[model samples]
Target: MSTHVEGSTDLKYVSDEAFIDTGVRKVVSKGNWQQQYMSLRSFPEGDRNCYKIGVTTGTKYLIRASFFYGNYDGEGMPPTFDLYLGASLWDSVKTSSSSDFTIDPEIIHVPQKNHIHICLVKTSHGIPFISAIELRPLDNSTYQAQTGSLALLDRLDTGVSTWTR
Candidate 1:
């Protein structure tokens, strides 16, 4: 399920909003996402803005974080920051030219513990902010690899022949 990090404390849902930077915005955009999005939490002022999500240990899952600037700060500038999964760096959120757009990054992994830590850290450019977070369980058969973490190389279509037979 997706969690909106405004002011929720439901354990089954996303808890621990009492300890993060808070910001409210009313953004009108062409995309439907901006409509459901009501608030955004920042990380420049806080010591550490993170969410502890409960999950089955040893289970594979996909976690995603989204950020929508929407010019909430009235500065028309999108922030650049880093997202961390547990102690490892996941991805960096970059700035967008428009406030109506959003930046979403996701990771797939098996947690070593019963809980996973999702954190947003400030960079040298701007403060970190998050619009939403999502955690989904995946079947073990999906994304099997032979060694360490696998990286995406390229995607090809087998239906279409590229070379002469």
Candidate 2:
């Protein structure tokens, strides 16, 4: 998990919502977690970490959350991590584990009809100060642009026409 920000090497620092110093001690819910960037600590502004995140069950493709730190070893401050892989509200899923998953992007396919969830159970198993996370999908080379941006792109401009072609 490469850092989107230069200094913040932890993958957990992506949403700015994943905070440790924001007076908020935790972040979780059955489905909805903290979406507000300014409210959380530890996390920084920008979603460069999510850039490497893709969704799918191991049947289709593995999820490689390539973050900076590991929730292994009893060293993390909180001792927990979580990952939500779906793009919509309906596709949300989760995983709570004691060990950290690998980040090697591969071609091994699996069944991922719904959303993928990779939660690093944040209280007992382990803890890590993440800086980035990378998930695995069949193809995510061009998904960085949010679908809602299609409308904005239609009316947007760069003062140049050569690139559009």
Candidate 3:
């Protein structure tokens, strides 16, 4: 059986209430969005906070993390933080401004164990927050990384004009 954690059927996102105990949930003061992005879990206390997700070992998966500041904290200044996959540094998440829509970071990785920890580390720029996280299993043969995991640099869609999730 697959060891991955299941999300809500309608939204396909695991509830933070069930998976994480830290951070207070805050709703966006502006913009109309789906239920997932409308609210976020903000970590204001800890230096590092993580969400542990179960996945099958040796399976190739596309893990995506989304951040939307929306000035949820009432502070106009957006925060800059670091994202880590376990002990390895994934990327530094920077928000240009509080009005910025969303920043989505994606990585393709094969776990060495049965679970993976997605951690957000505070960099003192602002409070760390996350809107959504998704894990989708992929075929092991595809996206063959020569040495380490692959991080998405850019994604372009030709035809679509309007914003999409």
Per-model TM against the reference: 0.71, 0.27, 0.85
C-alpha lDDT score of every prediction, in listed order:
0.66, 0.31, 0.85
lDDT assessment of candidate 2:
0.31
Clashing pairs in 3: none
What lDDT tens digits, residue by residue, belong to model 3 across residues 1-165?
A: 212233444435557666678999899878765567778899999999998888899999999899988888888888999999998999999975546468999999999999999999999698889998888899899999887799999998689667666
Residues 1-165, model 2: lDDT tens digits: 212433443333345243222222233222322232112122223221222233344333433433322222224433333333334221111223323332222112343444443332233333323433333344534334333211111224559777576
Q: What is the overall TM-score of model 2 with all chains considered together?
A: 0.27
- Encode model 1's per-residue lDDT on 19-97: one tens digit a residue: 3334322443434453334466666566346777778988888776777777666776777877888788788779685
> Clash number for model 3?
0
Enumerate clash totals for all models, in the order shown: 0, 23, 0
For model 1, the stretches where C-alpha displacement exceeds 4 angstroms are 1-36, 147-165
Between prediction 1 and prediction 2, the one with superior lDDT is 1
